[model samples]
Target: MAGLELLSEQGFRLDGRRAGELRQLRARMGVFAQADGSAYLEQGNTKALAVVYGPHEVRGSRGKAGAAAGALVNCQYSLATFSTGERKRRPHGDRQGQELSLHLKQTFEAAILTQLYPRSQIDIYVQILQADGGNYCASVNAATLAVIDAGIPMRDYVCACSAGFIEDTPLADLNYVEETAGGPQLALALLPKSDQIALLEMNARLHEDHLERILQAASKACKDVHALLDQVVREHLQEVTALLGK
Candidate 1:
C-alpha cells in the first residue's frame, strides 16, 4: 500500500488494469503425452503446470487407501527453485507447500465427482514454474483443465481468482506487488455452473463492509476464467476430432 500506487487517479491499477479486471489468461490441455492428463496455464506472469493421474488402485499405504466411499483425492503443490526472485533450496515439503497441497485437495474434492471411483485414487500434481501473485488461483485453474483432459467425471468446471481491497476498490486477479502491498486479499474458487463456491481464503484483515464487494469481484473473475477454460476444452476437442479424421 506504500511503495507503489496500487490504483491511479484514472482508476487504473499498477498494471494498467481496471479495479475488477483480471490479467491475461492463456491455457492449453494435454501438454504431456505420457501423462494421463496434463495442462499448462499462465495467468499474467504466474505460470503453472498440472498433471492428473489415477482412478486406479491407490498407491502407497493400503490403510490410507479409500474405503467404499469415494476416490481419494491427493494433491501435491510445489514451486520451482528458480520461480521466485530468491531461489528456494527445495521445491516442496515446506509448510507453505504442504498448506497449498491441502487447499488444492479440498478445492478439487468439492468439484470432482469422486464418488464415481470408489476404492481408487485420483492424484493431482501442480507445480508453479513462476512466482507471481495468485499462484493458488492459477494452480486451481490449471488443475481443473488437467482433470478434464483426463476424462474424469465432474459436476462442473472449477474456476478460481484472487481479489484485493485497495483504496476502497476491490481489485481482481492481484499480482505479486499487490499481494505484497499488505492489503487484505482473497482467493476464491467456484463451481460456476451451479454458482457454488469450492474454496475461499483470505489473507490480512478486511472490514466487513468491503467483504461483499471483494467476493463479488472474485466471483466475476472466476466466471470469466470458466469461459476461457471452456473454450480451451472445446478447441482441444475439435483438434482431436480433426486428427481422427472424423
Candidate 2:
C-alpha cells in the first residue's frame, strides 16, 4: 500500500481485473501416467503441478499413526530451482518449503475427509514452476484437482485465493509486485458449496475492520476459481467419454 500502486484510478487492479476477479485459470488433470493422480494448473503466468500418490500403507514411521483412525495427508511443497527470478539452491527441505509443506498438509486434511481411508497415507506434491504470487493457493487448487483425478473421495473441492488490502481497498489475486509491496495479504481455502473456509492465513498488520473485506474478496476469488476448475474437469470428462466411444 505504501510504495505499491495496487489499483489504478479506474479501479482496475495491476492485472486489469476488478477487486474480486481471479487470474485466468487453465487446468488439466491426470497429466502423468506414473502417478496415481496428477494435475497441472496455470493461473496467469504462475504454473503449478500437483501429484497425488497412495492411500495405501504408510511409507515411513508406522509408529506415528497414534490411533488417529484416519489416513494421513502428507504434502511436500517445492519450488523448482529455476522457478523464481533468482535460482534457488535447493528444490525442497528449505525452511520456507518445509513450512509450506506442513501448511498444505493441514489445509488438505481439512477438506479430504481422510477418515475414509484408515491407516494409509495420501501424498500431495506441489511443484511451483513459476513464482508469481499466490503460489500456495495455486498449489492447493491444483492438488485438489489431482486428488479428484485420482478418484479420491472428499468432502468438497478445496479452492484457494489470495487477497491484499491496499490503500483502504481490497485487491483480489495478488501478483508478485503487489505481494512484495507490503500490504496485508490473506490467503484462503474454501469449500464453495458449503462456504466453509478450510484454511485462512494472513501476513502483515491489518486493521480488524478491514479483515472482513479482504476475506470477502478472497472468498469471491476462490469461488470463481472453483467454477473454472469445475469447467475444466467437466470438459476433460467429456473428452475421455468421447475417446472411449471412439
Candidate 3:
C-alpha cells in the first residue's frame, strides 16, 4: 500500500505479469518414498511440500476407538521457520496455521471419496517452504497431488487459486506485494471437472457487483491449474507403470 502500485496503469503486475496471468507453476509428485505419497509444488515464489499417510485405522485419542462411517481426514499445516524473510516468524500451530489447516481439511473432504474408506483415516501434512503469497492455494494444490500419489480415490482434482481486485482490474495469482496492498482478496478451491466449488473465501471488503467478476477470474485460474495437475498425475502414473513392468 505504500510506494508501489498494486496494478500499473499499463495493466502489468509487479512481477511483470498481465492482470489475469498466473505465476509460473512448477511441480513434481512422489517426492517422498517414506510416506504413502508426497509432492512438491511451486506457484510463483510460494513453495510447498505435501505428504500423505494412512487411509488405515484412525490414530490417537482424537480419533474414535471404533470404525465409524466414512474416512476421517486430518491435516497439519506449517510454515517453516525460515519461510518468510522476517526473522520474527510465527511457529507451527500458530493461529493462522491452525486456521489454514482446517481450511485444507474442509477442502479435501469435498474432493476425496471418503465413503470408500469407511472407518479409516487419511493424514495430510503440508509445509510452506516459501511464502510470497497465495500460501493456502499452493498448499491445497500440493495436497491434492500428494493424495493422488497415494492412489486414493477422489471425486475430482481440487484446484485452487487466489485473485484480487485492484485498479478496477481483476488480478489472478497474487503475490506478497499485491496481497499486502489490502485489496479485496478471494481464495477459491474448485473441483474443476464438475464445476463445483469446494471452498470459496474472501477477505477485506468488495462490492457485490464486483464479486462475480473476481470469482470468474479465480475459477478460470483454478481450471488452468487442474489441467497442469492432470498432466503431472498422468506422467507420474506412466513412469510408475513402466518401472513396475520392467
TM-score, every prediction: 0.97, 0.95, 0.96
Query: lDDT for every model?
Result: 0.92, 0.88, 0.92
lDDT of 1 at 14: 80
Pull out the clashing pairs in model 2.
none
Please list the residue runs of candidate 1 whose C-alpha ends up more than 4 Å from where it truly belongs after superposition.
1-3, 62-65
Model 2 lDDT vs. the true structure? 0.88
Q: Per model, how many backbone clashes are there? A: 0, 0, 0
Residue 167 in model 3: shift from native, Å?
0.7
Residue 98 of model 2: what lDDT?
A: 96
Q: Write the per-residue lDDT of candidate 2 for residues 1-246, one digit (tens) a residue.
A: 555567888888877888777878889998999999999999978899999998878777863574158888889999998888886488349988998898898888888877888778888999999989899999999999999988888898899999998778888888888888886898999999999888889888888898889988999899999899999889989988998999
Per-residue lDDT tens digits of candidate 3, residues 52-115? 9979888875666444778999999999988998877686589999999999999999998988
RMSD of each: 1.3, 1.7, 1.4
Instruction: Supply candidate 1's per-residue lDDT for 80.
Output: 91
147-166 per-residue lDDT for model 1 (tens digits): 99999989999999999998
Q: Of the candidates numbered 2 and 3, which has the greater lDDT value?
A: 3
Rank list by TM-score: 1, 3, 2
